[model samples]
Target: MPLSVVDLYRDVLPRTNCKDCGFPTCLAFASMVVSEKLPLKNCPHIDPETAARCQKELDAQHAAGKWTRRDMAEDALQWAREKAASMALTDLPERIGGRLHGDGPDRELHLPYFSEFIRIGAGGIRKENGEPLNRWEQVFVYNHMAQGGRTNPTGNWKAFQEIPNTVSKVKSMRAHVEAPLAERFGGKAETLGRAAMRLGGRDLTNESRAADAVWRFTPLPRVPVMLLFWDRADEFDAKVTLLFDETVTDHLDIESILFLSERLTQLLCEDGTG
Candidate 1:
């Protein structure tokens, strides 16, 4: 079996929160070594002989393509494709709010993804411009299709913790979606607002909570996400919070929702304004 990050941290590394390895924790270093291709020799505390043995195993695993993040993502996309294959293309228009085009083997659903659109067919998911989607984007769209989009947005928003079975993903929501936005747009509400609006988001600052900036976005026809941002204050860091419609799970699961929010962050940050 290939050595996982956890296995490397627990079985090989010292498991100390030592910063000697130029990482905040041994587990962080282990994760980088396993997933990000960080050299194991970077950890000064590990014995040279043990490091050699583990590095050799990691090399063999990499050579065999048994331990790679891209491989895992591709596997996930394949699984989602299988599930989405069973969905009826004809029914997707009303279920997910997309236009069906072509006929027979050339059929596909052209669904609005933020400000852009994507083409989903039996072959694969791609951008409306005929650009192929990455594994993560493909997985997100496929999972959305596989869910059948059973319900519409209720317009009632709730925090990430308010959603069922989402306690584990709260940290991920902050790290991947909230923190990055807060860091990028803190004290720059105008820039953030412009970027948000560029992606078809609506300004809701007047009606929402006492946030410095508030925007609601409909990435999908049925999936609405609201973002609330606060500028940095005395002794308090800036913050960004996301709220989802109460019926969001009816269209997408928690994992897909996280990915959706992360994608939103990516788009807003890529707007090149701030």
Candidate 2:
């Protein structure tokens, strides 16, 4: 038989008045534990033995309820359909005029240039020469692209121009677009890097410059994804790179990506996929 919350508490929670889990009482923590909202590790009072036992129990529950990659893919496809219906687009377009032409490609069609960098503890953003960026600085350099709400100044300005637009849209409607998905599941949106679309009337195969924009997403916490986007010098072809955090890569199978992609694509397309 499985251990009930009562059994776990009676055998585990130290009945003391220790306000460790931010709860006024151990019983309150117990409630949270039963709901699986608070892990036993938060108690601070549990010894290693008890913590291990609780962890084992929770792990079992997670293994049983966890979703697979196929499940995510199905959910993502459904989400995409709904998004397409709302966006008034029967099928996603390739490009619109000089800009990207897709309705909600970011949700499903992985863009070419996306990447991730883990910032553990405090660190300064610096230029290539090791000069630290100012405290008021709005942009940080990552993979030859500038991130945050600032304009690029170098000759590479075209590489990061579209970021502001995407950030603005995401920020304006994050709750309406992202909250519901997160509530139903668990993940976060993050800005990983930037990219550029080919610009000018010249044939892309001969163009040297491209239009650029930032990349962002809601990812599972601690399970980061790497994205890479680049076009050939002629701008005729594009490429995408996806790097999964080794720690959680096994958890991020194709299905989860599909599900997340669908949800995001739907939200971005129709104005509300939350």
Candidate 3:
């Protein structure tokens, strides 16, 4: 049978977001393995025998042109593109929280993505500078457009686990999104706050909670995310919790939501890495 990214992620990988494989999550690493041909051994957690077997399977599939490269992401991207293409361009702004511009085949929806604006149109998604988005970015924005959700964000927030149909993804949320932030900005609440603000996040520490720091971000116009960080106090370890507006699912599926959080974490950690 052909090797697929999902197979590698669900069956072979540890699904722990250990970062031992130099990727943010097991899912991202799995995509790299199946799509970009990253070595399976890059993941130190895999046993020698299992790694060898999986490599053999992957190599055989590659030779036979049977490897399913980025199966889920590519499929979602295609579906989003077709869906967006089918929708009336003029109606996208009201539905997705963007502004419509131009006319006819050149029409585009300009939407806020984090601190930047992206133009989505017949040419697909691109940054304000006109650089094209990567596959994951495209998948996220395209999926948002395809959803055509018109509900406004309710100011109320909910944890990822509290969201409907999210049980299977809770571990992923911790491993990939919340855990990484806790690990990176654990005792550094001020640093974390600054990093977040650089990306247009607002400090909301005074509103509620005994957290060391609290911030909110509007990565997508309709999806507002709240991040709470508990600094490493005496006799306690640091913690990070992400809360989302109740209306998040109306605009994005669980997978895309996770990706959005992961992207925020990536941006927050960039300054430290430099």
The residue ranges of model 3 lying beyond 4 angstroms of the native Cα positions read: 1-64, 67-72, 272-274
Summed backbone clashes in each candidate are 0, 18, 0
In model 3, pairs of residues that clash are: none
Ranking according to lDDT, highest score first: 1, 3, 2
Which portions of model 1 show Cα errors greater than 4 Å? 1-70
Q: What would the per-residue lDDT of candidate 1 be over residues 5-87, giving only the tens digit for each residue?
A: 99998998888788998899998888888777788999988899989999998887877766555667878888888888888
- Best first by TM-score, ranked: 1, 3, 2
The best candidate by TM-score is: 1
Between candidates 1 and 3, the lDDT winner: 1
Q: What is the lDDT of residue 42 in candidate 2?
A: 88
lDDT of 3 by residue, 178-263 (tens): 88899898777778877887889988888775477888999889988999898888888888889999999999988788878888
lDDT of 1 at 220: 84
Score each candidate by Cα lDDT. 0.86, 0.36, 0.85
**TM-score, prediction 1:** 0.76
